[model samples]
Target: MPRLSTRTRLLLITTFPLLVLFVTLTWYSHQSRQEEVRAELAERGQLLAAALASSGEASLMGGQFDELKASIYGMMQGDSAIKRVTLLDASRKPLVDVEARTSGQPEARYFEAPIHKRLLYVTGGGDRNVGTMGYVQVRMSATALLAKQRRRFYIELGVASLGLLLCLSLAYRMTDGFAASLKSSMQALRAADEEKRRLLQRVNTAVEDERKSIALEIHDELNATLIAVRLEAQQITALAAQAQPAPLAGQIGDKARAITRLALGLYNSGRSLVRRLRPEVLDMLGLQGALEEMVNQYERNHPDCHFALQAQGDFAGLDGNVAISAYRIVQEALSNIVKHARARNATVALLRRDGRLEIAVADDGVGFDPAHTAEGIGIAGMKERVQALGGRFAIATANGTRIAISLPLES
Candidate 1:
């Protein structure tokens, strides 16, 4: 046998038993109808035979054959099932015979009743016995009864079949609905899995981009400072070996001061690079103060746009992951506004409400339609990151764009 689908198996499991039960009940009903029909026919036949024998007893004994024959034929005319009736004499000779219409009827059955003399006298009761005077026989055909039984059987069978079909149809519909719902859920799960993979790829890309940026900054700023310091040291060595030391002491001192200045610049460059890699400000000043410093830096860098921060919570003991993500999200949002949105004013909000960190970045700019436009790497990556941390993200745009994020604080 072929393997069945879940839907097919469920339907079979539910409907097979009902089908069997209905069929059994239908067959039983047909048999019971047949029995009842036969029983009724036999009772009717016996009654007709007994009544004829009693009514014709006097006429049969007086040798009045005409009156007895008239009585027998009259009953036969009224009952169409009476195929034949016979009046027998005491010597077993037929005195009268009558038949009713039997056109298109099946084989007949027989019922017999006896005719007893009305005169009864007792002389020696112990050993004397007398038999019945005469006999009456009736033959009946059950055409009508059998026809009724068949009609009843067919009607019952049809009803049972109809009920079975209805039940099966209902069960199939229910299974179909369940199968459809299950299919939809599976499709949704597949889509979510695909989205998760795409988000991971984007995250890796973002990391590579950050590394490249940091490498470029170090190469351009720190290397040049180190080369300048090396040139100053060589000059100091040349002046030290000079025979006229007093005359060139001022030159040596100037060279020493230049090297000192270059060393200080190189130190500042190293600190900036370290801050970019892992914000030590978050540890020194906490999340709120770090965010304040970040916003102040953005204002200084992007002089064309004004920025503000509204941080209203004790972010002293926040989870490290949540704090870092929140910082990156605000950083990306402000960069997007400065680069894409031709806006003059932007705001960043960080509030701790009900054991959760809520962050919102809003810019009064030429906002783009989210439904029509595809999200850029920054926004998409930010949204995926928040969701990965079991947080919610949303965006709204009318006069400006607002990206809202809510993160559950870890205990």
Candidate 2:
């Protein structure tokens, strides 16, 4: 099953139980209403039976059939709900039966009561009950009663249904509002992230450009001056060699040689600085050639540590930004391995597959815990550079340190 969003989950969680409760309450209400109607009908029927029995007492005892019939008819006319009236003698035999026939069986309520007569003395002081005269049976139609109950039930059900809908709608609206707010927050975060990436990209580009400019200035001005100074020192040393005073010539020649050595050291240091700022080979030979040269230099500098480079693909088509980022990533990785990774050999692989360039640098080194160690400027710069070009940077230190990057060729 597909996962549900917060809104959907909230809707189901809130509404399902309410739906079950609504159904249960409705059923319960219907049952209670039915029972109430039945009870009311039964009570009404009993009261009607009692009233008829009281009114028809004298007629029943006197055997006045016409009078009893008149009384029953009058009562029936007064209330249309009285469906049938049956008067019976002491033995349960019908004396006078008057029925208002209805269409259905067990469709109306029925009630019966006994009729009794009391004896009076000649002195006008009334006495007690003497005999049982007869009984009265009344059948009451419940159609009107049932109709009213149904209307009431319908009204209650409608109100309940409306309430349920209102509650559910409110819940839905609340969840939807929450979800909208959450979505807005997420969009804002993404926008901020995009802006941060753009800013970092611009910074990296400016810094690289400055480094290149400074390298060119140093190479053109400072290195040229040092070369000129070195040539003059050598020419002075050659001229001083033919001087007549042996000690003076030896001292001057030694001084000139010393000056030339100092100038030579300064020139070499300047050149090394230029290379550190920006390697010209990167521009001349492309990313692959630059990486090979860098690896050779690293091996030379760290004689104990072995370095190897393997390259495959048309790196010529790679974008400049992507190439630089890849180069820098590899450069930083190797530097870290040399500084921290206490191991012998490192491997650098550059491959292009499916329109993207992949670079992996791994070393058989004592890997350090990434969580415990903070990344220095070099590692951080490499990460920022890769992200600036819309690429991925991943590093793992378990087993051995590995840094992997993938960049789109077009980008």
Candidate 3:
């Protein structure tokens, strides 16, 4: 069977037993009504027999058959339900028989009463029957009793049906209210989730824009100033080369050289910071070339640790959003490895597989348990960024730590 909703399930659970109870009660009522009808008819029969026996006592004793017949016929006329009224002698012989024929019907029910004569003296301080006179037998048809029961059944059926309908209506209203409440709650939750996603996406875009702006300022203004300072230092060294006093000239030359070295270091540091903020190469070279350049930079910076990049398929057509997320995720993973993983080697893999772009970064390092370690903001931000692009992000650590993320090729 197909699944039923809460309303339907509740209706079945609550109403099935009630239906059974209704049927049982209806049957009981029918049986009780039948019994009552039979009893009422029986009582009426007994009363009529007793009355006829009393009235016909003298006629029966005096052998007045005509008088006995007249009394029975009179009673039968008064009550058409009385099908037959028979008077019998003490020897059970029928002296008078009066029957009103009801053709084409089943045999009527019979009720009998014994006739007795009172003695002149009472025994045990009470009236006593001295001798048997005769008996009165009355037969009654069940049609009238059946008719009463039918009417009673119809009335009971109507009442029960009305009660059942009322109960079902109440149950339906209750279930409808409950189901509606649940649906409202679910819709509210869905709306809240959608709003949260939109907010996160906006935040990610704003942060990226800020990074790009800051990177541009550092690269264009700060690096230009540092380069000018280095050039001036070189000019001062050339002037000191021809100084009058040799010692003073050497001292001035050394100072100028030191200034030049310091300026060069500062300029290199600023460039590194700018690259970390936003690699300009990412915009110029696309994801695959930028990733390869990043790997080469890492290898040159940390020659003690091996770094490798393996990229398949052209990433020139990748969306800007996906490219940035992928690059940032890989950058974060590599930063983590450099800072924490006391490892000898690391690998970055970028591949297009099954219409999706998959990136995997692995390091042969002293892996720490992810469950025991709290994730830093960088990792959390990367996860959010990947998810914002409708991608999956996951990290695992065993013999080595591995971070993997996948984004749909469409975006």
Candidate 4:
């Protein structure tokens, strides 16, 4: 069976008890109605038997059996509920038997009464004694009354069923409406997430463009000015060698050497800034070479730590977004490993699997709980880059902190 939604399941859970109570109450009411009908039938049977017994006693004592028979037949003719009537002598021997010849099968209820007359005591003490004359037994038919009750019960059951169905329909409608509302809300949230990803991707693109522009400006303007200063200082050193006074010439040569040193140092610093702003190596070497170069630089910087790179599959002609996001994720992971992990060994792996790029960075060092780890380690930025490209990002810290990411390639 298909699984029920939360709303539907809750409705069923809440309704079950009420459903059971309704069934139990319906059955109890039906049984109570049946008992009442039977009791009334029995009461009428008793009253009828007693009345006939009292009236027929005089005729029975006089041996007028014909009148008693006529009286019983007439009573049965008027009342269809009466099934049979029988008169018996004091010895329990039946005298007159009268029955209603009903067409259909009829059920019966029986009642009996003793026929008696008041007689004076033999001692004439003024108190009367009772003498048994005969007995009368009456059986009343309960088929019609019971049938009416059954019909009423059937009607009640049908009404109850209709009400139950109506309630269920209403509940189903409510659940359906709730499910629909929930679905729409979820869809809206998904749409909002997509919009956010698009916006982030645009912002990343703009920022990268600005960085490239700044890098070009520094390479063209600042590097040229520093080179001119270095060239002028070298020319001064050459002129100092041709001066007449040896002491002055030596001192001027020393000052020119120091100025050249400062100019060269500033020039080198400017070149390094250009490289950081936008690494030209990425454009020249592709993702694999760029990553290998990065790992080498980190290893050179921190000789105490050994960094390894394992690259598989072709990285040529990859999408810029895929390459950059992967690069940034590995960059951040390595930075975190060096700064926080206090690791002696770190590994970076890149794979092209099933038209997607998979990147993993791990360090065999101290690990920290992700929940407690500060976002200053650039973990949040890496996750956003992956999410903006609609990829999966995961982190594990079993042995040490490991960041894994997968981004789709534009086919």
Could you estimate the TM-score for every candidate? Answer: 0.47, 0.61, 0.56, 0.62
Measured with C-alpha atoms, the lDDT of residue 93 in candidate 1 is 86
Give residue 356's lDDT in candidate 3 (0 to 100). Answer: 94
Worst window of 10 by summed lDDT in candidate 3: 100-109
Q: Which stretches of candidate 1 lie over 4 Å from their true place?
A: 1-267
Q: Write the per-residue lDDT of candidate 4 for residues 1-411, one digit (tens) a residue.
A: 999877777578667876998889898988898898779878888999999988987888788888878888888778777888889999989888888897534454479999887675678566453788889998877777777888999998999988988887888788777878877887899999999999889987887789889999889998899899889999999999999798899899899999999989988998888877777888899999989999999999999899999999999999887777677678778888888898999999999979899998989898877588666638888888988899998889878878888898888
| Total clashes in model 2, counting residue pairs 3 or more apart in sequence or in different chains | 0
Each model's C-alpha lDDT? 0.80, 0.85, 0.85, 0.85
What are the root-mean-square deviations of the candidates from the true structure over C-alphas? 18.8, 11.0, 12.0, 9.7
lDDT of 2 by residue, 1-411 (tens): 899886787689888999999999999988888788678767877898898788788787677879878777887677556678899888989988987654423444469988877787889787778787888888877666677888989998999999999999998998898878877887899898888889888888888899989999999999999999999999989999999798999999999999999999999999999987887788899999999999999999999899999998888867776777787788889988988898798999999989889999999999879799887788788888887777888989898898888876674
The ten-residue window of minimal lDDT in model 1 covers 120-129
> How many steric overlaps does candidate 4 have?
0
Q: Compared with the true structure, what per-residue lDDT tens digits does model 1 show for residues 47-113?
A: 9889988887877878787887777677767766677888887777888887766573534568889
Among these predictions, the greatest lDDT belongs to 4
| lDDT for 181 (candidate 2) | 84
What C-alpha lDDT does candidate 4 achieve relative to the native structure?
Answer: 0.85
How would you order the candidates by TM-score, starting with the best?
Answer: 4, 2, 3, 1
Q: Identify the superior model by TM-score, candidate 3 or candidate 4.
A: 4
How much is the lDDT of residue 365 in candidate 1?
A: 96
Give the lDDT of residue 184 in candidate 4: 85
